[model samples]
Target: MTLAVCGAVSACADTSNTPASQRGFFGGIGAAVSGSDERRAAGLEQSATDAERKKQQLEARLGAANADAARTQVQVQAAEQRLAAVRSDLQRQKERLAALRAGSPSGSSAEEAARLQKELDALERERRAAQDASTAVTTATLRNLEERTRAIGVALDRLGAV
Candidate 1:
């Protein structure tokens, strides 16, 4: 009878049939064996680090783009000013040529008129050249500004997503 009772008690106490979590007092050994918590922590840490690195790279790119845009804007303004000054000078040269033509009917006056005409022609050519250069500079500045704007937008979107 005692042998039968001992066999029943041993069978009831056998923890091999139970899960590891249920076998331990606090399931500490089971957590160590799975290591899920530690892995999750490591994954989270790596994600944070990657996010920070990406943000820094974006910031640097944005700064550079902004600086480039500013410089291009300044160049465009300078080109416009130069074009305006050339146009003003051309107008003054035309008025001077007209005045010379109206002065008198003498050989010396005629020679002066011809000289003024040549100067007027040169001024017109300079004005046209300045206008063309201004147009090219403005176009380039606009293109650069648009590209930088697009890059900034993309960076902002990425930052939001992160």
Candidate 2:
């Protein structure tokens, strides 16, 4: 009777075949729970990787845009300087023309002076055309740079929100 009772108790407490890791309270529950946890962790990791990649790409584009803007600024400055010089030269030529007109010369010399005046006028017109073109180009470039900067700023704002 005692042997029979011991056998019954031992059979009821059967844990010898169970793996060590699965021998705790609610141990079998880990199999289902661990699968979900692993999937969640993997998803979070992938999201982090994607966000980082996007951030790096945005930063690269911003850097390139800033460099382009800097170069454009330098070019605009150079154009402005050239335009200023051309205008200064035109003013000086105007002053020389005025002085020549005031001091009337003899017949042949007057003809020579007239030819010189015509050449100076043509040069002035060419310089004015060049200045106008340079100004237009610089204005357009600056406007483009400004718009690009605004776009980059908006992109950064969107990225930060993400």
Candidate 3:
């Protein structure tokens, strides 16, 4: 009776720690076992770590892009202010020239007026060019920032899914 009990107890004992090849067909004494579960857990951990690292990198990129956009905006504002100042100066010069013309007409008055008009025209052209250049630069900067923002957003979304 003792021998039969021991045999039955040993047969019913758990063998999850034993290699599948070594365990008999009756290895179902306990829950199923394999290295796959542990490997899968480790793989999941690695994937999660990679996702976190990617998310952090994307966030850094987004921060840098935002800073650049802010700096570019400041530069654009300064340029616009400079253009406004130039336009104001041009207007003042025109008013002063008109006052001088109204006060007198002399032998050289026609020539002097022509020269002043040409100078005013040149100044206007210069102001227009500067304004256009500033606008172009601002546009390019905004476009670059927008593209970077979109790319970063996509990367963040992928990280979230992961």
Off by over 4 Å in 1: 1-31, 104-135, 138-162
Candidate 2 local accuracy as lDDT? 0.57
Residues 1-162, model 2: lDDT tens digits: 966654554444434344536545333334233343456568779999999999999999999999999988787678777556555654665565556556665576566556655655665565566566763565554344334434433433333333
> Which is superior by TM-score, 1 or 3?
3
lDDT by residue for model 1 (1-162), tens? 866654554444444335555655434343444454466568779999999999999999999999999988888787777566556655654664565456553565566556556655754665566567664655554344334434433433333333
* Reference-based lDDT, each prediction: 0.58, 0.57, 0.61
Model 3, 68-122: lDDT tens digits are: 9998889889777766766676676666567666766455664665566576666
Ranking by TM-score: 3, 2, 1
Local lDDT at 24 for model 1:
54
Model 3: how far residue 29 lies from native, Å? 9.2
**Cα TM-score per model:** 0.53, 0.53, 0.59
Candidate number with the higher lDDT (2 or 3): 3
Flag regions of model 2 displaced more than 4 Å: 1-34, 106-162
Cα distance off (Å), candidate 2, residue 44 = 1.5
Please report how far candidate 1 places residue 71 from its true position, in Å. 1.5
